[model samples]
Target: MMPKITTNRRKWKADLMNRVQTVDDNDRPATDYTFKRVTYFKPLGVTAQEKALSVQEKAEVVKRINIVMDHTINTKDFGIRIGEQLYNIERIWTDDEKREMELSLSYVD
Candidate 1:
């Protein structure tokens, strides 16, 4: 069974975006991303983890958030934006009942 969502917890909002490719004046290829307001849905949960390696001297952080499922969401054509930061969708998990989905997102600063 899915966990219950409360009204007070529904404070977080995110945008669903689609990537578009375009050519610049110099004939160089570029990406033009457009976004649409999905809804004001709260994250069911959040998990943050960090990983580091000495050889590469690089650190990576991945955050997982769950929200109520929207039928329009698809991994192939859409991304998630919270505030001004854009996140890459690494994975998506939808419940059997299709009530909610968990999104694995990663971004580097």
Candidate 2:
């Protein structure tokens, strides 16, 4: 057998045909009826380089560097392969290079 209507069709039908009362005279146009261009901003990839660290940031940097340096030296003493690579990287890092890196590190990190 066909099922009885479970929904109220009259209430739903009346909603779409409801009359709207105008605030202004029907002849005068709305001043702010400007159609703003629908802006479709593409999915923004909010990726960017890290900013330079300030003195507060530098403190964290120094702490990390010291710990890393100690780890590298200890690894070298133990004859680990990475110890040499770490040391080599250390050699390549001059004071000027470090300062520059410190400035840029915040952004990268």
Candidate 3:
């Protein structure tokens, strides 16, 4: 078995958000989501390239982060929020022992 995950390594905190749409009594459209606490690592900086006007241009940098936590079945249909920025779940991987999981997330508009 692998070594236990130490809490000291997890330095950042993030929230998992699920998008929910509803209608108020007035029939106005509303959209929002709830947040759940999760531990995440620091984001890694990355530059994005976009094709603009038939030319390859450097777009804004998009940071990607990894969230590591105990095994859980509800990883899908959720987005991660760090501070004022929000990141969409890209992928998920679990350890061989199935004791932990790591979620790959990227920034989204």
Candidate 4:
């Protein structure tokens, strides 16, 4: 199904990042890592789901977002960052026409 234009409002801005391996002064790979910002996108929509057993329960939070089709994103090397929270791309689905892509993301925490 095509995304509804009205519902697909570009309200949220997110950063597309590529994981980068750090190197030590001697040029050896370091244990630490960083991310390089690939691009910024204003998502068509942002949906957040939080499941909890009780009012005080801390549950897993998942975020789903839709954006215009971008060829630069690959699940193996990229991630999405919204605000201060970083998420791993769990799955990616593209529309039949390749006009849009839906990303299922899981919170890093």
Task: Write down the worst ten-residue block by lDDT for model 2.
Answer: 9-18
Rank the candidate models, highest lDDT first: 1, 4, 3, 2
lDDT of 4 by residue, 42-100 (tens): 44333333233211344243666777788777776777888888877766778858477
lDDT tens per residue, model 2, 18-71: 122235676754222222122111111112221123343442221112111121
> Residues 20-95, candidate 1, lDDT per residue (tens digit)?
7789999999766688766565554343332332113342335666777777777556677888887766667788
**Candidate number of the best TM-score:** 1
What's the CA error at residue 100 for candidate 1, in Å?
0.3
Query: In model 3, how many backbone clashes occur?
Result: 0
TM-scores, each model vs. reference? 0.66, 0.13, 0.53, 0.59
In every candidate, how many clashes are there? 0, 3, 0, 0
State the lDDT of candidate 3 residue by residue for 1-109, as single tens digits.
Answer: 9999775455788777875667988999865666765666655533233113113322232445544555543535677778877766655556656345665555564
Off by over 4 Å in 1: 1-8, 44-61
Ten contiguous residues minimizing lDDT sum, candidate 4: 47-56
Clashing pairs in 1: none
- As a whole number from 0 to 100, the lDDT of residue 80 in candidate 1 is 79
Q: Which order, best to worst by TM-score?
A: 1, 4, 3, 2
